[model samples]
Target: MTLKVERLGHSTRLQEVSFAAQPGELVGILGANGAGKSTLLQLLCGVLEPDAGQLTYQQRDLTQISAYERRQLLGYLPQTPVAEGGIRVDHFLQAGLVNLHLSCPGKELNRVVETLQIHALLERTLDKLSGGEQRRVHIARALLGDHNWLLCDEPTTSLDLYYQLQVMAVLRAQADRGKLVTLALHDLGLAARYCDRLVLIDKGRLLAEGAPAAVLTDANLAQAYKIKARWLCTDEGVTLLPSLLS
Candidate 1:
């Protein structure tokens, strides 16, 4: 499956921005603060409608899909996922599947729960968990439905170094399994290491889109982020180090 955004715009927050994500690809949306990264994700997930463009999934216009039908194919984890303080972690996760009247195999749910390391927190209420724990719980909830496309906004926020890596690994594994995963991220190094494609935006416009190495050039970073950076490729992987403020 593929998601195509043609000249999508959202009021003053985003201009005419277009991009696409295909199955089996991990697309990272990278930009500075207020650079339309979150806006783009919101538009893609149908949280906000574009004022002046079209969004298509597998050649069908997204607007033509019923809200309930759309939700079945797309899973979204907003930057600040709201969880009722009263709901337990397990209940919250199960609600994701239940709301759609979808049945995820018990083993599939168990796999996501175990991958996120949230097995112990299942009984705890959302109000009782730490920020990172809650983030993991919400992430596990998003992964429950096996949707064709997953759009996550700053999912690594509040996560520590270890959990952040673990979360990225899980997302990468999802992409490897042929799911389209798109996320808004501020960490260039993490995006470089895990994402198959990078979409760089600035001032409400798309600046670059391609392989990480090509799209994350010094010129592009300087233009989009206003920073001097160096790219290092090692046996392990790619690393983008910001040298100095531009």
Candidate 2:
């Protein structure tokens, strides 16, 4: 069964936002700062209890599910992931397995390390790594298990463009391999190119939800961001030019 949200609300941060995502689709949550993208993701991963509405996945009602069951169903990466600065990368990743109660730590660890290309950094401590490297490790931790549903808040934030595309590509590949991956991303270009569908949130409400070309239109940009922007469209995909922001 697909992941479904019906009239979901959380205080004033989010209100009556509803959407559905299926396995094999990468969904991007697009919104301005404080537009409830992060809040919506929290409800998806059970970080916050909804003050209203329903959340269900795989024929199970997530709103009423046990913590253990929720753990089994969702894997999450917070907007600002934290770890002991002194902890070694290996141990840090291993801890995620322990926390999530995952099996075959060695196998799982190797898989994520390989996918994220972080094998060489395994012996380094968290404080020693650069921002991009730390973000990669955090993503690896969130991806420890074979979760069908994954939620991440701004997985590409604060990284250089290279890392941004790398991380988004990894998540997109995961979705192609049959996982419902959702992430809140500020980069419209990344979201347009990598996400199978987009949910445009504005002022804690759903402004639009559809294909990239449909959601990232001139009208939506003006309404959601209050800016005049340009889209460079090509055979490959759409790319939003920040220079055109006015």
Candidate 3:
């Protein structure tokens, strides 16, 4: 799956932004608040149509696809998961898989639960779970259904260090399995360590896109977040360290 955005817009925040992500790749959208990160994810998920641009899947016009069909292929985790009804974890996940209409009554649910490390909370009510647990459960629900593309916005927004790392690991594993994972992350270090590629956005425009070492440079980081940072490359991969701003 490749996403192409040409002259896309919404109100005054997001302007004509364009970019693409190949299959099995993890692309992180990096920027500060109000930089249109969330808006861009919404556009990719087809929740909001581009005011003036093209959004296609496999070289075919996506606009022609119905909403139901789009839901079948796209899995979205918004900044805040919808906390509706006193639904139980197992039931919520079951609801999410209704669209696929496939046969995953037991194995798939257990896989996601184990993958996200939420097996203990399976029987608990959603409203009773902790924030981090809820995040993991929401992700499980999104992954329960059959979807090829994942659009996650600030997935680890409100979680402790442990849960944050766990979420990142889950996404990384999905990417390794040849699935497209696009995420918006504020933690530059987390993005650098986990994502395969980076898409830097500033005020609704794409500033840079490439490997972490290439895009998370001091100059680009400063321009995007108004901060100074150094990129250190080791055999492991690129690491970002914040430098004195003044």
Candidate 4:
């Protein structure tokens, strides 16, 4: 089944943005700050309603689904860490599965903890961890469920380069395993390297949508980010290295 947004719009933010993504694809949403990336994610997850268009999954109207069903379909990770209390990480992760009423909560916890490499942080209190560590914990919790779509907003924000790559890899692996993974990223290099497809939104409109190589062009970079960027081709994929605006 494919998830699609048709003519998605919000009066002040987005304007007739349209796109579609299917399972097993890592889709990246890229744009300048306040370019409606977060708003787009929120609309997809039903956190905000589009005043002008529709969100559909496999031809079913998403706006008509119940809250519980919507929860089962989408897992969202906000840009800021939402769990800041002093709860133990293990308990926190377990609560995520429990809230979903999973039949095998323990199994889910083990899967996420191992996949995210957060075994060491499992026993620590949430508030005691650094910002990056907390981000890892949140990511693990978000991954605890078997949701079809994972919408992440800047999941790599506070991480060092190592952890940033680590998190991105886990997300990519999720896409490989037949889940639709979409994330908002500021790192053009990472977005181009890890994402299978890119949705470049410039000033609240979709400027381009296609493979990373097709979307991250020099003109797109200058128009969206106001910078002259060079695309470096590598064996892995293309990477955008931005230089000063001409």
Candidate 5:
């Protein structure tokens, strides 16, 4: 399956952005603050309607799908996920499946909870957890339904270095399993290392889209982020070293 956006715009927040992501492709949406990355994700997940343009899933207009059905097909993790204070982590995770009308299989929940290393925190209330821990709980919830498309906004935010890598690895595994995973990321190095493709946005416009090397050019970085940076490729992966403001 492929998700295609055609000239999608949301007021002045976003403008004429277009792209297509196929199953098994990990597409990273890269942009500076206020560059409309969040707006684009919202449009893709049906949270916000576009002022102009259309979105299609496998050649059918996305609007043709009912919102309830759309929810079944897409899994969204917003930047600030809502975690009700009084609920325990496991209860919260199970509730997500209930809302989707999916069976809350014990094995499925255990798999995600273990993958996210939240097994111990399962019995703890969300209010008792740290920001990073709470984030992981929400992530496990997002992964519960095994939806076709996973749209995440800063999935690694508040995570330590180890957890950051773990979250990226989990997302990578999802894409490898033929799920379309699109993430809004600030870390260029992580984007270069893990993403199959990159989409660069600047001032509500699409500046570039291609492989990491092509989209993360010195010229494009200067134009979009107004910075001078150096790129290094190692046996492990690519590393971006920003020197100074342009």
Candidate 6:
């Protein structure tokens, strides 16, 4: 699945921004606060409609499709996910899969739960889990159905170092399996490590889009973020090493 956004616009913020992502690609959107990253994700998820331009999925206009059909092909994780009802974690996940009409049985559910390391909290109420834990459950639910596209906003927020890497690892695995995963990330280092592509936006406008190493250069960081940062590449991955701003 590939996505094309041309001249996409919101009411007050983003304007005429465009980008594209191919299948099995992990595209990370990097920007400072209020960069319209969340808005872009919401638009792509069909939660909000663009006033102008075209959103195409596989060369088909998304606005022409039914809301239900558009949702069935996309999975979205917002910046802040609020869990509803007094449902237990496992029950919520089950309901999510049911709503998507996925064919996953008990075994698959167990595997996903275990992979996220949330098996122990399955029986717990959603409200009982920590913020990070709840975020993990939300991720598991978003990934429950076999959706082709994932639009995640700030996926690593509230997660500790361990779980942060873990979440990125899971996202990378999803991309490897031919899913188009787009994430709005604050952590540039993590983005470089896991994301196959990067889209940089500033003040509701697209600044750059390409490989992390190229798009996340010292000059680009300074230009978009107004902060001096050094770029280092190793066999492991690219690193955004920053010095004290003067």
Best by TM-score: 5
Candidate 5 residue runs with Cα over 4 Å from true position: 101-104
**Tens-digit lDDT string for candidate 4 (1-246):** 887888889976898888888999999999999999999988887878889888898788988988888777778898875655989999888778755867877888898889889999989999899989999889888887878889999999889989998999899888989999999999999998899999999888999999988998878888999999877887876676688785
Give one digit per residue, the lDDT tens place, for model 5 in 1-246.
Answer: 778888989995899999888999999999999999999988888888889999998888876787888778889999987659789888888787765755557877888888888889989999999988888888888888788889999999999889999999999999999999999999999999999999999999999998998999888998888888887888988778987673
Lowest lDDT sum, 10 consecutive residues, model 5, at 96-105
After TM-score superposition, the amount by which residue 185's alpha carbon in candidate 2 deviates from its true location, in angstroms, is 0.6
In model 4, pairs of residues that clash are: none
Kindly report which residue pairs in candidate 1 clash with one another.
none
Model 3 Cα lDDT, one tens digit per residue, 207-238: 98889879887788788888897767777655
What digit string (tens of lDDT, one per residue) describes model 2 on residues 102-219? 5677898899999888999999999999988898889888898878888999998667778787888899888989999999999898888999999999999999998988998888
Candidate 4 global TM-score: 0.95
Question: Against the true structure, whose lDDT is highest?
Answer: 5
Counted clashes in each candidate structure? 0, 0, 0, 0, 0, 0
Kindly give the stretch of ten consecutive residues in candidate 6 with the minimal lDDT sum.
96-105
Q: Give the poorly placed runs of model 4, Cα more than 4 Å off.
A: none
Query: What is candidate 4's local distance difference test score?
Result: 0.87
* Greater-lDDT candidate between 4 and 6: 4
Tell me each candidate's TM-score: 0.95, 0.94, 0.92, 0.95, 0.96, 0.93
Total backbone clashes of candidate 2, pairs 3 or more residues apart or in separate chains: 0
Cα lDDT for residue 110, candidate 1: 89
